[model samples]
Target: MVKLSLCAIVKDEEACIGRCLDSVKEVVDEIVILDTGSRDRTVEIARDYGAQIEHYQWNDDFAAARNAALQYVTGDWVLVLDADEILHPEIVPQLQEAIASDRHLAINLVRQEIGAKQSPYSLVSRLFRPLPGIQFSRPYHALIDDSVTEFMAQQPDRWDIGYLSSVAIVHDGYRPEAIAARDKLSRIRKAMERYLSEHPDDAYTCSKLGALYVQNGEIEAGLKLLRKGLKQEKHLDRLLRYELHYHAGIALSKQQKVGKAKSHYEAAIALNILPALKIGAYNNLGNLYMQTGDLTGAIAAYERVWQIDPNLPIAHFNLGLALKEKGKLNEAIAAYHHAIELDPTYAEAYQNIAVILLKNGKVFESLDHFRKAIALYERRDSPAGSELRSTLKEMGFKI
Candidate 1:
């Protein structure tokens, strides 16, 4: 039995601290929280869960706050989590077993971004032994990877890094609403820009900030940073390389440089990385193929996506589109049904199914699906609802 501690840095996280604490209370032997000037009941909530709370001055640097929290951890292993994240219950036993191993100095846990549509899963080095040499780095996206690498380099064969394939944490911070509430975009940009100023050639920061730039509609600047990141041959790790190429592909695609984007996507997909991590590149590549009228390529890419993660509704929906375009009506309908099965409220899938049903002369069945889709779309205030209503009217139906 190994002692596991939960360490976190929080400020004004009253709404989510209790949820975060509850998820790990049964698993961790100790709870250490570093409060960085919380003006709310964050400390009070944490105290209810028996968290050892310490006050620290608010600093813009996340790594500084994280490192400060680490000093208070007494347990042999630390499980780092954010206030907006909860440990998945199913991964607890596996996590315990991994941490108990004498050979593993650190364990990387897979995190599922709750509200993100693309690249929903990510790997985070959250579980590790609290060794003196192991500390966090980077200001915005703080991580212990650099320190862990440095420590491992000293005794390359003495310790091993472990990984859990199952999702360990469910993070809610990436949601659109959450991002808006936290003003995360501007805050992260400011921090990363400052960090990049100091370390211009940092590939990790380049990948992250470059992606942020692309998302903010600064495609040319984003491409410049992404290409700069690719040029850093020595500092590029497998994950960083994948991100650089993936983001470069996104930027290139936005510019309508389909050929370059396809090449970059191929490069990203070719990387010896986790198949789940390549989902975004594959999905985007599939879309590109669809744009170029390469239905076969599009179908293959989408099928690959669903095979990697069957639960992804978008993959099935995209596959349905490709199959529909390829004249495989039955297969298309089946794919649409899979998408609906994964996400019952998927209005677009229902609409597509209705279109296919009508094409096959199943008028009444098509109308039923159209009604469902229209009702769902109207509830979401989507313009598709009115468009669908008009389409039905033109077809001599009054629903």
Candidate 2:
């Protein structure tokens, strides 16, 4: 029975820290939190969970703060987690069982970006043994030292790191406006500045920095770094290529290089990597065609997704929109209906169908759909329902 130390470093995470700690409290032996000047109630919430808290000074060095937190771990194995991350309740026993078994030294629990369902973006080193030499490296995006990397590489077969299927780390890092796209870019730039200063020729850092630039709306600079990284690195990671192509496509599209953007998007789809990545590529293609006033092309791209996954409500909704734009009102209505069938709680599809009904002079039917949409949206606590309700009222529909 191997004991576990769940370690984390956080700052100003009052909105979500309690949720994170609560999720994994029962699974670990000790909870160690390193706070870096949080003015919010993050520290108080952590205290409520009986977490051992230590104040770490703000130094723009993540690895340093994390290493300091590691010193408090009494467990043989350490489990690292971010402030906004939580493990799914069902997989708790599976994780404990894995740690107890004599199969592997470390386990790579899939880090899933929330709202994306089961699509895991990265295999973060979340669980590992607390060996003396297994020190972390890199100041910003630091990972375990080269010795661990080399050890893993040497015994690729025997030095096993099993990926637990039933387990997942759901990260809600993108939930708030403070940590959204713009803010993400700002943090990435700071991290990139430190990383690039030390390792100028590193492909991973270059690719990541390029992606940050793209998110920040620096199209030319982003393209320059991506292209340079692709050209300079001989054997680029295929996974990295998927992200590079996706971001590069967005940059090209922003630059009005529609043809080039489409080419990159096509290349991404051709990779046949993760299904989420495939869906993203197809969505981008639909968007590109929508921007170009090629309604038929947009419909075709979205429709392709339906063939691959008919139950995907977003695909059906997007297809309906494209069809409606092309004046295929009957087909569009059918598409929206399919979307609603796929997801009974899909407010957007109901609203879209209502709009189409109103356009076709079916005022009574439109009112009914709008009511349904409003009901679903309100139940889900969405602001969009207010506008929908107002529209219904203005149209003389009895609420």
Which one wins on lDDT? 1
Model 1 residue 336 distance off true place after TM-score fit, in angstroms? 0.9
| Candidate 2 C-alpha lDDT tens digits along 1-399 | 678889999988888888898888888889999999999999999999999999989787777788888888899788898888997788788888777766566776756565542122455667877766566766655666354666767667666666575436878775445467437656658877688878877766777788778867877888888887777544765656776777778789888999999998887777745454466678888989998999988998898777756766778889998999999999998999998898898888898898898898998898889889999999988988988788667877776
**Residue 139 in model 1: lDDT:** 87
Per-model TM-score versus the true fold: 0.96, 0.78
lDDT of 2: 0.78
For model 1, what is the error of residue 267's alpha carbon versus the real structure, in angstroms, after optimal superposition?
0.6
Model 1 gets an lDDT of 0.94
Model 1 per-residue lDDT tens digits across residues 102-182: 999999999999887768888899999999979998889999999999999999999999999988999999988899998
Q: Looking at candidate 2, what is the lDDT of residue 364?
A: 83
Poorly placed runs, candidate 1 (over 4 Å): 394-396
